[model samples]
Target: MDLIGALPRLAARRPPVLLVTMPGATRERLAVEAELTGRDWPSAPGPAAAAGLVVAGRAGGAQWLGDLWNGMPRPRAYVAVAHAGDAPHALDLLGRLLSSGREGDAPRAVSAGAPRGAPGQGGGDGPDHHPGAPGSGARETPGDEDGRSGRGGQEGRNGRGQARGQGRGQGQGRKQGRALGLGQGRGQEQGQEQEQGERGQEQERGQEQERGQERGQGQERGQGQGHGGHRGGVAGLPMAGRADDRDGLRLDRLHLPLGPALADWPAGLVLDVALQGDVLQSAEAHPWEAAPAGRYPFWGEPWLRAAGGEAVTRGAAERRRCASHLDSVGRFLAVSGWPRPAARARRLRDRLLQGAAAGELAPEVLRLTRGVARSRTLRWLTRGLGELPAGRARELGVTGPALAADGDVHARLRVWLGEIERSVHGMDDPRALTGVDGPRGRLDGPRPPSRLLLAALLPLLPGAEFACARLILASFDPDPDEFVGAGHG
Candidate 1:
């Protein structure tokens, strides 16, 4: 065979080959290896010594060469074969490759000038019966196992090699003639196991491919059914509608959080709403569809859409209002008799500032929130609240709320939240705020009862500490429509 054309023939004693071919080429190379490469993805030995990279088309294994040398002590050579007869070019293309290895034949140790067993070839198969002989895998005869026997013998214990046929008189001669099948059978088992392992992996890969194809087919069928429904000219879903982002209307089969299932309605109707800090953040009144709006969904239709956040649509302003189970905070503020939720926040902020200056807040509170409220003064209020100057509140363990864990217990915050909520919602009047002064001159002015805007914040905070500390979130009217859009539609 032409050595260059027959690379595998040349590589029978070379390093393992790794065919880094793409999909189309992968199948091709696998078949080629069976007939040509004489290697496979698994049987390749180390990560380093894979034989040849049989790639597809062109530019196959070029990019992968550098990455191969990254952390390796001695990088293995690459043979990028996009087509046949590319082996010689691959060797030439690689500038540096490990040279053929030295130290193959073991040096014979001889006395001074005794005739050495030449350079190559073992002592003519005499001691070859030993396990480490040239033909190590080959078996020996039973007679060879006996110390008195030579490499070829018909007596004593049988090794693996067969002996010459002899007369039937001697038992050793007869035994040698009749070979035991022990060593020969073991060799066959090893080959069978390797074949079985390869077959197992191939079966696993086939199963994976089958599953993938099944999933793809299922997805296609579902898409086809949806397309057919739209083309049938439905009333709720428009045939021309794209995805929600591209089309004003979004049409897909989805559930309404609080309404009947879409499967009940031939034209799937859905509704969605989101709120933050007791105020509507955004509202979308359109369908997961857009063609021509249906004869305006009935006002009492439980799942009617609203302009939660959609752009102005034709006659959108005429749609009936949608009620959101949102803005619990705003509802509570309304319930609490706090006038004008939005306006009261400004007033509350001023009072907190006043309390800071008057030394009304506990000393630790000032330290935590105001960085010690630095000032050059020796006033009485400051002296009393900052230091223990025999004050009534100071005398009691309730030294205004504690700042540190030791000073103030978190459990107290829970109690305080309840008390504040009760006060805000009219469960208890603001007058019940024992040590606090009424609205006006004092910090935290006891405002004349009016609606307060706390993050449009509802007074019914969920967590105990939040109720106590008033951990209310704020609403930001990010878009101008938030105010003008009233989301009435």
Candidate 2:
């Protein structure tokens, strides 16, 4: 925008006018040259070279004022005079801009009065303005300024020559722009059509799916109707008479007898046998459908339990065998000696003596007792005999061989006996015995055998349970037996 040198030339040379075309604020466009020239230089182009210049003011067309300078006789000398508020800069550049300005009279019609406010009638533009007046080949109207109507409007209306020049210079560019715009419009329309086609296809697929679903439902209903029709026909048929009802399992005769040897039937066939007092007589084979219940063991001995029957022999079953209960008990008793009964007997004897001396037991019991402890897992049953009765606390303490060796009852009582020993020796508080309802009144109790199963049989033996628990530990460590219990007795 700075034009310190161009201002003096504009005024000295008196270029008729200047033309400018650019998009900017109005103030900047109008004051651009004047803003740049701080003061006028002494020498510049005179009125002989510089004259009024013209520029397009409107936008949105390919024929902008920039088009005039696009093809120039020189590049660095391209500044035209400034317009509006900027007109002073062009007038100021009159002296220095002389060598660069194009000197020519303005066209006769359009330049008629630019030197003054009277359009084409002003004298200040001098002789150059009248030289190009008749360049318009058309006739002039008398009342029109510059022999035209509106200045820019007249150019637009009657622009055969000017438009031809502007259009020829920008011909290829304008055509390309129009072609691009057309292509974009076509692309937009095609996109919309493609979207609509996809929607239509989706709607058609949805309708087809609905039809298929309807067809399937109709087929199912038809099948149900056909089944009902068949069932109705079956209902019309008559049923059997009452005589056949009572005979639930009718057997077919397997073989006809001709007073000869008996022929064996096939193994799998079920039969109803009629015998004469444990003798084989006649057999009528029956189908599985008509077979009587609980006779399945006749099929084979392998399935005796499943058939709800037991094997029986007609003979050789009632014979004698050497057997007695005493012998079995004697054998079991034979293994009981040494540390088992002798050691057991002395301990019980000692307890009796202590109980009598302490007045906890009847004195009569110490004189006539034997000790035999039975093994049991329940703390109650195995110790019952040695325990005092519920209310009869004075019963003989060690009367029978009650806590016999290695029986289920003996194992359970060992716990209570230990408690009693602890109480006797000050190992346990005597007052604690009242809390458990123990030895004096709590002994001699009876409970069912399932207590043994729950405590001993159902739960694993301690050693066995330890080994079973180790199975889980093995998943974590390679050497589990070192920490987990080994399966030892």
Candidate 3:
């Protein structure tokens, strides 16, 4: 039985996939075939863990692609989708790649001579043990009474003990000398043991004294003392000024960057958040390089094309809108930690993308809406969260779900469900597309409404817990591609 001959059969087994999504790459959202083919999208899959790689959307920067390719495990398959609509084609290519196995483009095994483990560390055969480790044969030498084997203290003591025994043996009569030698040997051993005990005691006292001194120094340093008048930076990180926390106690500020590459987050939006405990103290958003030049934002494409006078059909536009709403709903559900409905929403979204007629889609959509809306736990979690007053929303020029929901995440979901229902009915209007209404907002404006949505959301995050803050942001589901196409960084 040749092991190499078995490789092809083993490779045919269903492969787990790691999705590396880039800006404008929403193809992974429509992966309905994943369930059918036994493909899994785990929360986090490393290169070695995933047997296949899917680069969704146009490939991103060269550095990112290179890193991903380098990290992929052997026996790996790769497929790329140039646009969100090309997911099905990419899946076909991926299937062929996987099925080919060792006969075609299977990944090469790692070189036997490849360098292993961290720098200066032994090869990856597991951890290296020190002299103090168990099974290391590190027992103290019999003569090392002072435990300072490196200082030659044990050698000197042994020499003196032998000399005392020998001198006593010479001074006494033959038989008496043998007995004296034995007695002196016993006495010398006792003396050495006593000295070793005293030495150990002294060493412990010295260590305690040193620790006391260090603690005093640490206390001085803790009193807002630092080299440049800043509280000693946390391990070289700059220390911002202190602020009053919710408990009225002043606390140091820590700035952390979340997302731009986070799980379930919109791609390319980085939030530089200042946090105290699990609470968001403040946040500033930095957008990534604008979406690739010239492509319409996927969620708003229909309205954008219509506004551009492309003579788009109303049914097509409505289909896009419903799909867009489902996309948002799926993401919201995922962030809320409810995967069942989120997956259902995504399946419906894919069905819509595959040209499912409204008559066929309406029942499931209604069922999903009813099931999600009936979740009392979800409502309790989202209630009163990120409240956007109507006047303020209008002042900020926000439209779409934000305006319709009057600004709470709970209300926003309600508005999304209502719009999805309306979209189903509007599918057969047969009218020529004229307006710029989209899932996010009107597309006739110079700037996408989502840009304003992110801005309006910043103020709502300060007092919220980090988890709630993430949910609030997910509820909005602002498209980062909008910012990129608008020339934002």
Which candidate leads in lDDT? 3
lDDT of 1: 0.24
For candidate 3, the 10 contiguous residues with the lowest summed lDDT are: 150-159
TM-score of 3: 0.65
RMSD of each: 37.6, 55.8, 19.7
TM-scores, each model vs. reference: 0.16, 0.15, 0.65
lDDT of 2 by residue, 97-185 (tens): 34343342222212212453222322113332221133321111111111111111101111111112222212222232122123333
lDDT of each: 0.24, 0.24, 0.59
Candidate 3 wrong stretches, greater than 4 Å: 1-12, 27-51, 62-78, 83-244, 486-489
Lowest summed-lDDT stretch of 10 residues in model 2?
316-325
Give the C-alpha lDDT of model 3: 0.59
- The true-versus-predicted C-alpha distance at residue 232 of model 1, in Å, is 52
lDDT (0-100) at residue 293 of candidate 1?
21
lDDT by residue (87-111, candidate 3, tens digit) is 5555555555666653324221111
* Stretches > 4 Å off in candidate 2: 1-18, 28-66, 72-77, 80-87, 99-162, 167-489
Instruction: Report the C-alpha lDDT of model 1 over 1-489, residue by residue, as the tens digit.
Output: 565434433444454433333222222232333333222222231223343322222221121122221211222333333333333333332212323222111211111122232221121122222111234321222222111111111121111111111111112221343322222333445445545666657666555555444544544443444345332112111123233322244434221111101101111112222222222222222221221122222211211122223333222221111010011222223222232431232223223322222234223222321221222221211121111122422223222112111211222222222322222223112121222211101112222111121111222222112112112211100111111111112
